[model samples]
Target: MINMSILKSLGLSINPKLHVTVLTGAGISIESGVPIFRGKGSMWEIPEARRLAMRASPPWNNKETWEFYEWRRKLVSQCKPNAAHYTLVEMENYFENFCLITQNVDGLHIKAGSKRVLELHGNMWKGRCMKCGKIIDLPETPLKTLPPCCECGYPLRPHVVQFGEPIDNKILIEALKASKEAELFLVIGTSGVVSPASQMPILALENGAKVIEINPNPTVLTPYMSLSIRGKAAETLPKLWKSFFTD
Candidate 1:
C-alpha cells in the first residue's frame, strides 16, 4: 500500500467523479519491449539508422521506408501490453470522463482495451496512399512488394507523423480540448520536452487541474506537477490505480 502521508504531502486525492486525462509517451511502451526511436541509446541516434529513416520518407526512397516500417510492425506485433497499459484502462472505467493522449505510434494502449485514446503520433500498422490519400491496414509482413501501391496504384507509406510533419489538426484540437477540461491530469513516461505535446500538462495547470507525473527521472515539468512519482510506469501505475480506487 502507498503511504497516505506521501499522498497528503503531494496534494493528490482520489475521486471517481474527477474528469481525468492521461498523457503517455515512449516510456510506457519501453516495458512492453518497444524501442524508443529518439533520445539517448535510441536507434534513431545511430548515424546509419537516422540516414535510413530520413531517406525512407520520400517517394524516391519509398522501398527503404517500407522496409523499415515493416520491420517495426513486426516488432510491435510481438509486444504485449504491460501493467501500466492495463492500469490506464482501469482508470478509464473509474473516471466519469477520461481521455488518454499518447505520443507513441505503437497501438499497445488500444490492444490493452483503452477505449478513449488519442494517438498524437499515427499508428504504425496503418498505411496511407501518397496520391489518393486513402488510409488502409498494411498487408502481412515480408510484403510481396518492396513498396506496395494503393488500390488506385499510388505509393503507400506508413501512416505516422514523421519528423518535420505537422500532427493531424483534428487530433491536436481534441487533445487541447481534453487538457483544458480535465480535473486531474497524469503525465506518464514522457520526456516533457517535446513541443506542443509537452505543453499539455501546463495547459491543465492553467485550467486549474491537478497534475501527477510518473517517470523514472525528473523532467522539465517536474516542478509543476502536483505529485511526482519517480519510477517506471509498469511498476508504478498499478500501485497508483489501486491506491486511489480500491481503498
Candidate 2:
C-alpha cells in the first residue's frame, strides 16, 4: 500500500484540479524486459554496437547500423508495457492537464494508451529518411530491406536521438514548458543522469512545482523532491493512482 503518511509528512495535497506532469526513464521498463543500454545484457554493450548507436561513428545508412537496428526492433517488439505505464494512462484521465515525458524510446507508454506522451529520445517504432527527412512509422515485422528506404528512395534511420546528438528542439521546448507549468511533477524510475531530461525536474522545482520522486533508491534528484517514495514504480504508481479518488 502507498504510505498514507506521505500525505502528512510531505505536506502534499492532491486534488483533481492540479496539473500533473510525469517523467519516466529506462528503470520503469526494466520489469518489461527492455534491455537498458548500460546493463550487462544490453544490445549496445558490445563495442561495435555502441559505435552504431552514437553519432560519433558510423553513418546511419551503414550496413552495421542497419543490422543493429533490425535486431533492436525485434527485441523491443517482444516486450510489453508494464503496470507503471498503465498507471500513467489512468493518471492522465484523473487529471485535467497531464503530460508524460519519457527518456525511453521503447514506445511502451504509447503502447499502454497514453495519449499525451512526449518522447524525449524519439521512438524506436519510427524511422526517419536520411535524404528526404521524412518520418515513417516502422512495423514490427521484418522489413524486406536492411536499410529500409523511404518512398523517395532514400535510406531510413532509427528515429531515436543517439548519444552525441541534441534532443529535438521542438520537443525539448514543449517538455520544458510542461515542467514549468506543472503543479505537481512526478519523477519516476529514472537514475537522474541523462541530460536535458535530467534538467526537467529541476525546472519544475524552479517554477514552484511540488516534485515527488518514486524510485527504488535515491538518485541525484531524490533530495530535491518534496517527497521521495521508495518502491518500484509498477507497484507504487498504481497505489498513488488509486488515491486520487475520494471514495
Candidate 3:
C-alpha cells in the first residue's frame, strides 16, 4: 500500500480545487483483457504481425490493415471497464481541473464515464476517410467490406495514429497545455519510453506538478516521480482513491 503521508507531503489530497492530469497507456487496460502491442507477450513482437502492421497503411496493404484493426475492435468490444477506469471517473468528478491523456485507442476511458479525455492516439471506435478526411464512428460489429468506403467512394481507415504517422497537432497542443497547467500528474500503466507521450510527465514536472507513478514495474520516469506505487492500476487506484476520499 502507498503511504498516505507521502501523498500528503506532496500536497495531493481529496481537495476539489486541485488540478489533476492523468496519463494512461495499455497497461491500464490489460486487467480488462486488452493486449499490449509493445511489451512481453505483445502481438506486434511476432515477426509476421510486425511485418503486417508495418505495411498496414492506406495505399499499401489496406486489406490486412483493416482486418487487423477490425479484429482488435471486436476483441475490445468484448471487454468491460475495470475498477481502475471507474476510479478515474471518480477523480474527474472530485477535481475542478482534471484532464485525462491516453495513448490507448480503445475508448475505454469514455466508456468508463471520464469526460475530459485527450486521446493522443485516435480512437479505434472511429474511422477517417483516406481521401476526403471525414471521421466516422465505427459500429460494434466488423464491417462487411475489407476497407469500408466513405460517401465519396474513398476507403476509410481506422481513426488512429498509425505507425510512422505523426500525432494530430491539435491533440498534441491540448495535451501539452494540460501538462503545463497540472498541479498533480498521475502516470499510469505506460511504458514511459514512447516519445512525445513520454514527454508529457516531464512537462508537468518542469511546471512544478507533483507526479505519482502507478505501475507494477519501474519505468524510465520512475526515478523522477514524487512517489512510486508498485501495483496494477485496477488494484492500486481504487485503494488510493479510498485512502484519500470517502463518501
All candidates: TM-score: 0.89, 0.90, 0.91
Error of 1 at 13 (Å): 5.4
What would you estimate as the lDDT of candidate 3?
0.86
Over the stretch 1-247, how does candidate 1's per-residue lDDT look in tens digits? 3544443444556767778999999999998999788767787766765676666756432899987787677768889999999999988898878999999998899989999889998888778887888987764676778687788987788888888788999999999999999878899999899988999999999998888899999999999988889999999888877666432
- Which stretches of candidate 1 lie above 4 Å from their native place? 5-16, 45-51, 59-61
lDDT of 3 by residue, 116-234 (tens): 89999999988788678798877666788877777788878788887788999999999999999999899999979998999999999999999989999999999999888899999
Query: Which scores greater on lDDT, model 1 or model 2?
Result: 1
Winning candidate number (lDDT) = 3
Candidate number with the higher TM-score (1 or 3): 3
Error of 1 at 15 (Å): 4.5
Error of 1 at 31 (Å): 1.4
TM match of model 2 to true structure: 0.90
Model 2 Cα lDDT, one tens digit per residue, 62-137:
5566677766777788999989999999888878889999999989999999998999989988888878889988
Highest TM-score among the candidates is held by which one? 3
Q: Mind sharing the TM-score for model 3?
A: 0.91
